[model samples]
Target: MSALPNNPPPNVSKDAVARSLAEAHRLTDPEITMIFRIEKPGQESNPAEPVKLLEVNPNTTASGIMPVKLMPHAPSGIFFPSVIVEVHPTELEDLKNGNLLLPNGWKVNYDRPL
Candidate 1:
Protein backbone atom coordinates (compact mmCIF):
# COMPACT_ATOMS: atom_id res chain seq x y z
CA MET A 1 0.00 0.00 0.00
CA SER A 2 1.08 3.59 -0.66
CA ALA A 3 0.48 6.77 1.34
CA LEU A 4 1.17 10.49 1.29
CA PRO A 5 4.20 11.98 3.02
CA ASN A 6 3.69 11.82 6.79
CA ASN A 7 0.27 10.37 6.07
CA PRO A 8 -0.46 7.76 8.70
CA PRO A 9 1.45 10.04 11.05
CA PRO A 10 4.82 9.39 12.66
CA ASN A 11 3.17 7.51 15.48
CA VAL A 12 1.37 5.12 13.17
CA SER A 13 3.30 1.89 13.28
CA LYS A 14 3.78 -0.63 10.49
CA ASP A 15 1.46 -3.06 12.24
CA ALA A 16 -1.22 -0.36 12.32
CA VAL A 17 -0.97 0.00 8.59
CA ALA A 18 -1.50 -3.70 8.06
CA ARG A 19 -4.37 -3.84 10.50
CA SER A 20 -5.94 -0.69 9.11
CA LEU A 21 -5.83 -1.97 5.57
CA ALA A 22 -7.25 -5.29 6.64
CA GLU A 23 -10.07 -3.68 8.56
CA ALA A 24 -10.80 -1.19 5.81
CA HIS A 25 -11.09 -3.89 3.20
CA ARG A 26 -13.21 -6.06 5.44
CA LEU A 27 -16.16 -3.67 5.11
CA THR A 28 -16.24 -3.59 1.33
CA ASP A 29 -15.10 -5.39 -1.77
CA PRO A 30 -11.36 -5.02 -2.13
CA GLU A 31 -11.63 -4.83 -5.91
CA ILE A 32 -13.71 -1.66 -5.75
CA THR A 33 -12.92 -0.32 -2.34
CA MET A 34 -10.62 2.65 -1.73
CA ILE A 35 -8.62 3.20 1.45
CA PHE A 36 -7.98 6.64 2.90
CA ARG A 37 -6.34 8.31 5.86
CA ILE A 38 -8.70 11.00 7.16
CA GLU A 39 -7.83 13.64 9.70
CA LYS A 40 -9.94 13.77 12.81
CA PRO A 41 -12.40 16.67 12.78
CA GLY A 42 -12.54 18.09 16.27
CA GLN A 43 -10.29 18.63 19.28
CA GLU A 44 -9.14 15.06 19.02
CA SER A 45 -5.42 14.75 18.42
CA ASN A 46 -5.04 11.16 17.32
CA PRO A 47 -3.85 11.34 13.74
CA ALA A 48 -3.33 7.61 13.57
CA GLU A 49 -7.06 7.05 13.55
CA PRO A 50 -9.67 8.07 10.97
CA VAL A 51 -9.00 5.70 8.14
CA LYS A 52 -12.01 5.57 5.84
CA LEU A 53 -13.33 2.69 3.80
CA LEU A 54 -15.09 3.87 0.68
CA GLU A 55 -16.94 1.97 -2.01
CA VAL A 56 -16.56 3.15 -5.57
CA ASN A 57 -19.50 3.06 -7.92
CA PRO A 58 -18.74 1.13 -11.04
CA ASN A 59 -21.15 3.42 -12.87
CA THR A 60 -19.54 6.56 -11.50
CA THR A 61 -18.90 8.04 -14.90
CA ALA A 62 -22.33 9.59 -14.88
CA SER A 63 -22.38 10.51 -11.22
CA GLY A 64 -18.68 11.16 -10.80
CA ILE A 65 -18.90 10.64 -7.08
CA MET A 66 -17.75 8.09 -4.51
CA PRO A 67 -19.26 7.42 -1.11
CA VAL A 68 -17.35 6.92 2.15
CA LYS A 69 -19.11 5.28 5.06
CA LEU A 70 -18.43 6.75 8.47
CA MET A 71 -20.78 5.98 11.34
CA PRO A 72 -24.50 6.13 10.62
CA HIS A 73 -24.56 9.57 9.00
CA ALA A 74 -23.79 10.30 5.38
CA PRO A 75 -22.91 13.63 3.85
CA SER A 76 -20.76 14.34 0.80
CA GLY A 77 -19.86 17.91 1.65
CA ILE A 78 -17.54 17.41 4.65
CA PHE A 79 -14.16 18.36 3.23
CA PHE A 80 -10.97 17.33 5.06
CA PRO A 81 -7.44 16.18 4.38
CA SER A 82 -7.16 12.57 3.22
CA VAL A 83 -5.02 10.07 1.34
CA ILE A 84 -6.69 7.92 -1.31
CA VAL A 85 -4.85 4.74 -2.21
CA GLU A 86 -6.31 4.13 -5.65
CA VAL A 87 -8.36 6.03 -8.19
CA HIS A 88 -9.67 5.01 -11.54
CA PRO A 89 -8.10 6.71 -14.53
CA THR A 90 -11.46 8.05 -15.66
CA GLU A 91 -12.39 9.30 -12.22
CA LEU A 92 -9.26 11.35 -11.57
CA GLU A 93 -10.99 14.55 -12.60
CA ASP A 94 -13.95 13.89 -10.39
CA LEU A 95 -11.69 13.02 -7.47
CA LYS A 96 -9.81 16.30 -7.98
CA ASN A 97 -12.92 18.45 -7.60
CA GLY A 98 -11.56 19.26 -4.10
CA ASN A 99 -15.06 18.67 -2.73
CA LEU A 100 -14.38 15.11 -1.68
CA LEU A 101 -15.30 15.03 1.96
CA LEU A 102 -13.49 13.83 5.05
CA PRO A 103 -13.80 15.00 8.64
CA ASN A 104 -12.82 18.60 9.53
CA GLY A 105 -9.14 19.69 9.50
CA TRP A 106 -8.55 17.20 6.73
CA LYS A 107 -7.59 17.77 3.11
CA VAL A 108 -6.13 15.75 0.30
CA ASN A 109 -2.80 14.52 1.53
CA TYR A 110 -2.05 12.52 -1.60
CA ASP A 111 -3.73 10.96 -4.61
CA ARG A 112 -1.41 8.10 -5.29
CA PRO A 113 -1.95 4.65 -6.81
CA LEU A 114 -2.60 1.57 -4.73
Candidate 2:
Protein backbone atom coordinates (compact mmCIF):
# COMPACT_ATOMS: atom_id res chain seq x y z
CA MET A 1 0.00 0.00 0.00
CA SER A 2 1.17 3.55 -0.60
CA ALA A 3 2.48 5.36 2.51
CA LEU A 4 -0.69 7.29 3.11
CA PRO A 5 -1.89 8.75 6.41
CA ASN A 6 -4.70 6.32 7.29
CA ASN A 7 -3.67 3.39 5.08
CA PRO A 8 -4.10 -0.15 6.35
CA PRO A 9 -1.57 -3.03 6.73
CA PRO A 10 -1.31 -2.96 10.53
CA ASN A 11 2.04 -1.27 10.95
CA VAL A 12 1.07 0.63 14.14
CA SER A 13 -1.10 0.08 17.16
CA LYS A 14 -4.26 2.13 17.80
CA ASP A 15 -2.99 3.17 21.20
CA ALA A 16 0.22 4.44 19.65
CA VAL A 17 -1.75 6.30 17.03
CA ALA A 18 -3.89 7.88 19.72
CA ARG A 19 -0.81 8.85 21.65
CA SER A 20 0.69 10.48 18.60
CA LEU A 21 -2.50 12.42 18.02
CA ALA A 22 -2.68 13.32 21.67
CA GLU A 23 0.73 14.88 21.25
CA ALA A 24 -0.70 17.38 18.82
CA HIS A 25 -2.81 18.86 21.57
CA ARG A 26 0.31 19.23 23.67
CA LEU A 27 2.13 21.04 20.90
CA THR A 28 -0.76 23.43 20.50
CA ASP A 29 -2.54 23.77 23.88
CA PRO A 30 -3.74 21.12 26.25
CA GLU A 31 -6.31 22.92 28.39
CA ILE A 32 -8.33 24.57 25.65
CA THR A 33 -7.33 22.25 22.79
CA MET A 34 -8.91 18.87 22.17
CA ILE A 35 -8.32 16.34 19.36
CA PHE A 36 -9.84 13.02 18.42
CA ARG A 37 -10.80 10.84 15.46
CA ILE A 38 -14.21 10.37 13.79
CA GLU A 39 -14.22 7.50 11.34
CA LYS A 40 -16.25 7.36 8.16
CA PRO A 41 -17.30 3.74 7.68
CA GLY A 42 -15.84 2.26 4.48
CA GLN A 43 -13.61 -0.42 2.97
CA GLU A 44 -10.44 -0.97 4.99
CA SER A 45 -7.88 -0.75 2.19
CA ASN A 46 -8.75 0.53 -1.26
CA PRO A 47 -9.18 4.27 -1.77
CA ALA A 48 -7.86 4.85 1.79
CA GLU A 49 -10.31 6.32 4.22
CA PRO A 50 -9.92 9.99 4.87
CA VAL A 51 -8.30 10.87 8.22
CA LYS A 52 -10.94 12.67 10.24
CA LEU A 53 -9.97 14.69 13.28
CA LEU A 54 -12.26 16.67 15.57
CA GLU A 55 -10.25 19.48 17.03
CA VAL A 56 -11.87 21.81 19.61
CA ASN A 57 -9.86 24.82 20.58
CA PRO A 58 -10.63 28.28 21.79
CA ASN A 59 -8.35 29.77 19.19
CA THR A 60 -10.17 28.63 16.07
CA THR A 61 -13.28 30.21 14.62
CA ALA A 62 -16.37 28.01 14.51
CA SER A 63 -17.73 27.05 11.11
CA GLY A 64 -19.96 24.48 9.46
CA ILE A 65 -17.43 23.30 6.90
CA MET A 66 -15.22 20.28 7.42
CA PRO A 67 -11.92 21.58 6.15
CA VAL A 68 -8.91 19.37 5.32
CA LYS A 69 -5.47 19.85 6.76
CA LEU A 70 -2.04 18.38 5.96
CA MET A 71 -1.67 16.84 9.40
CA PRO A 72 0.29 13.70 10.21
CA HIS A 73 -1.27 10.28 10.60
CA ALA A 74 0.53 7.26 11.96
CA PRO A 75 0.44 4.06 9.93
CA SER A 76 -2.04 1.35 10.87
CA GLY A 77 -3.76 -1.72 9.45
CA ILE A 78 -7.30 -1.41 10.84
CA PHE A 79 -7.31 2.27 10.16
CA PHE A 80 -10.44 4.18 9.25
CA PRO A 81 -11.50 7.08 7.05
CA SER A 82 -11.48 9.84 9.62
CA VAL A 83 -13.81 12.87 9.72
CA ILE A 84 -12.17 15.55 11.82
CA VAL A 85 -14.24 18.43 13.13
CA GLU A 86 -12.57 21.58 14.33
CA VAL A 87 -14.52 23.79 16.69
CA HIS A 88 -14.11 26.21 19.54
CA PRO A 89 -14.36 25.06 23.15
CA THR A 90 -17.63 26.87 23.54
CA GLU A 91 -18.82 25.12 20.42
CA LEU A 92 -17.97 21.78 21.93
CA GLU A 93 -19.86 22.58 25.07
CA ASP A 94 -22.69 23.82 22.94
CA LEU A 95 -22.66 20.55 21.09
CA LYS A 96 -22.82 18.68 24.37
CA ASN A 97 -25.54 21.00 25.62
CA GLY A 98 -27.62 20.47 22.47
CA ASN A 99 -27.02 23.96 21.17
CA LEU A 100 -24.81 22.84 18.24
CA LEU A 101 -24.91 19.86 15.97
CA LEU A 102 -22.03 17.78 14.70
CA PRO A 103 -21.80 17.48 10.97
CA ASN A 104 -23.83 14.47 9.84
CA GLY A 105 -21.93 11.12 10.01
CA TRP A 106 -19.23 12.67 12.18
CA LYS A 107 -19.27 11.30 15.72
CA VAL A 108 -16.76 11.59 18.48
CA ASN A 109 -14.38 8.58 18.42
CA TYR A 110 -14.03 7.82 22.15
CA ASP A 111 -16.72 10.25 23.30
CA ARG A 112 -13.94 11.99 25.26
CA PRO A 113 -11.47 14.80 24.80
CA LEU A 114 -8.05 13.86 23.45
Using lDDT as the measure, the top candidate is 2
- Candidate 1, run of 10 with poorest lDDT: 71-80
TM-score of 1: 0.36
Stretches > 4 Å off in candidate 2: 1-9, 29-31, 41-47, 71-84, 110-112
C-alpha lDDT of all candidate models, in order: 0.39, 0.56
Candidate 2 matches the true fold with a TM-score of 0.57
Q: Which stretches of candidate 1 lie over 4 Å from their true place?
A: 1-19, 22-28, 40-44, 47-49, 53-92, 99-103, 111-114
Please give, for residues 1-114, the per-residue lDDT of candidate 2 as tens digits.
Answer: 333455444665444555555575567666546676665445323334455567777777876545554434434332533444677877777766777765545555656555
- Over the stretch 2-73, how does candidate 1's per-residue lDDT look in tens digits? 222243335544335434454545455545544444334552244434344333434334443343433211
How close is every model to the real structure, measured as TM-score?
0.36, 0.57
Listing every candidate in turn, what is its Cα RMSD in Å to the true structure after a full C-alpha superposition?
A: 10.4, 4.9
Count: clashes, candidate 2: 8
Tell me the lDDT of model 1 at 14. 34
